[model samples]
Target: MSSLSGRTAVAGIGATEFSKKSGRSELRLAAEAVHAALDDAGLSPADVDGMVTYTQDANQEIAVAREVGIGDLSFFSRVHYGGGAACGTVLHAAMAVATGVAGTVVCYRAFNERSGRRFGQPDARLGGEPSSQGLEMSWHVPYGLMTPAAWVAMFARRYMHAYGATSEDFGRVAVAMRRHAATNPAAWFHGRPITLEEHQASRWIVEPLHLLDCCQESDGAVALVVTSAERARDLRRSPAVIRAAAQGSGAGQMMMTSYYRDDMTGLPEMGVVGRRLWEQAGLGPSDVQAAILYDHFTPFVLTQLEELGFCGRGEARDYVAGGGIEIDGRLPVNPHGGQLGEAYIHGMNGIAEAVRQIRGTSVNQVRDVRNVLVTAGTGVPTSGLVLSAG
Candidate 1:
């Protein structure tokens, strides 16, 4: 087992309300989330000695500390990539805690994705930069392949041709996620369940991807507090032990689109992370009671299942059919409605849902959820986690 396994646990999770417009600055949102997470952990700002966030986040770590009343921090770090860095943030925190670099660590991400800098629209920011990622993206942006949906659609089309998967199959995933979100009052889609027909009727953003298939352009912030397993267990509230956490970049990896790979049908990066997570946790697919697979796009949800060993290489099309991913299905996924139905605060909110499943506090709680799998963004260098009961 990895030394990080069972060494650190998530003692608290907090988030600003998932919304279309928060009307607050991203820094304020981060401060609110950080303070709330500390409160949930029964910890004060003075106790935090480390902080982690996405490099894309507008708020600086020291600024967040000043706003949230956090004192001097001995460790601070940032992960690169867009939503792909979700679980990687926790991985960094676990490493810090396990190595005695920090006693208490907070991982947070805050953004006004809808109200400010909508990622769905084609923006010149990436190609305008001097970095290699920008140079790589410059080639595709000129060919009308700029938005994330367009980038993912190239792979989705190939996946269909290779695996015989249909748009209906993808719609089933959308329906299930919205169904779960309908029941979750905290969800943006609360009481707004959609039928598979509704999914089909939604306008197409790109061929093989309906407007409904894409995750929301939400505005929100989420934060989690990580501490030693010993301290977490002693806290008043139950903790979600970090059974395993991993980050991986697959062969021929690129920032958002890696379509040039010989075989672009699968998420090999997720496969790399999945193998490490299971080996670290000493568990496999069958051992997991539920999952919070990233649902940035409905098709990638199917691809993740295949890469993560939930099914055969080309068998996810069959595996996800027949209510296979619902609450009572073989592997209940995204019990909190995921990024599709819930607000997309990157993937941090999904990690929080996994913690809730472990604590038996989720409104869509799974039965005997001793272990829950949570994955970050796909189609890029990504991360995953195996969370177990305290």
Candidate 2:
């Protein structure tokens, strides 16, 4: 077993209301979310000596620290890539707490993705900086591979062609996520579930990706508090132990559009993440009670299941069919509606849902949630975590 397993735990989680527009600055949103998380953990800002956040996050670590009244920070770090860095923030924080690098750590992501600068639009900010990412974008952006949807569409199309997967099969994922969202009070899609037929009829953004299959362009923030296992016992909420945390970047990995791989049908980076997670946690697919697979797009969720070994390769379409991901089904995924249904606070919302499951406080509660699996974005260098009830 990994030494870090059960050494650290998540004592708190907090978020603002999910919305299309926050009407506030990104820095303000970050500060508000940080304070709320500290409240949930029964921790004062002075208790936080460590901070972690996404590299794409608009609010810097020092900026958030000062705004939240944190006096001195011993550990501060940032993980890169867009939504892929969501779970990684927690992983970094957990490691800091586990290894005695810091006492209490907070991982956060905040942005005005919708009302401010949008990631979906073609970025004019790439001024050819002398960086690896700038180099990768240079080859594709000029060729009109400008947006995330278009980058993922290339693989989605190839997966469909190779496995005979249909757009309707992809729609089933959208239907299930929306169904779960309908009952979640905090979900933006509360009481607004869509049917399978509606998914089929939705307008096409790309050739096999319907508009309904895509996640929302939400603007918000989320935060999580990680501390030692001993300290979590005295916290406000039931602690979700960090059973395992891992980040992986595969061979020949590029940005969202890594078409040069030996097989374009798979995400090797996520497979790399899955291997370390199961090995470190000493658990398999059967031990997991639920999951919060990243759902930036519906098709990627299916791929994540296969990559993470929840199901065999090319079998996710069938695995997810027949109510497989519903509350009463085999492995309930995204019980809090996920990015497709919940507000897209990046993948941090998914991590919060996993914590709720272990705490036995989720709206769509599952029985015997001893272990919960959570993953970040699929396309690029990715990350995963196994959260469990201590």
Please tell me which predicted candidate would have the highest lDDT against the true structure: 1
TM-scores, one per candidate = 0.99, 0.98
- Write candidate 1's Cα lDDT for 1-390 as tens digits: 346798999999999999999999999999999988999999999999999999889999999999998989999999988888999999999999999999999999999999998989988676888689878998898787899998999899999999889999999999999999999998999999999999999998989799999999899999999999999998856989999999999888997789888998999999999999999999999999999999999999999999999999779878889999999899999999999999889999999999999999999999999999999999989999999997
Which pairs in model 2 have colliding backbones?
A: none
Q: Write the per-residue lDDT of candidate 2 for residues 63-106, one digit (tens) a residue.
A: 99999999899999999877789879888998898788999999
lDDT of each: 0.93, 0.90
Clashing pairs in 1: none
TM-score of 1: 0.99
Q: Candidate 2: misplaced stretches above 4 Å? A: none
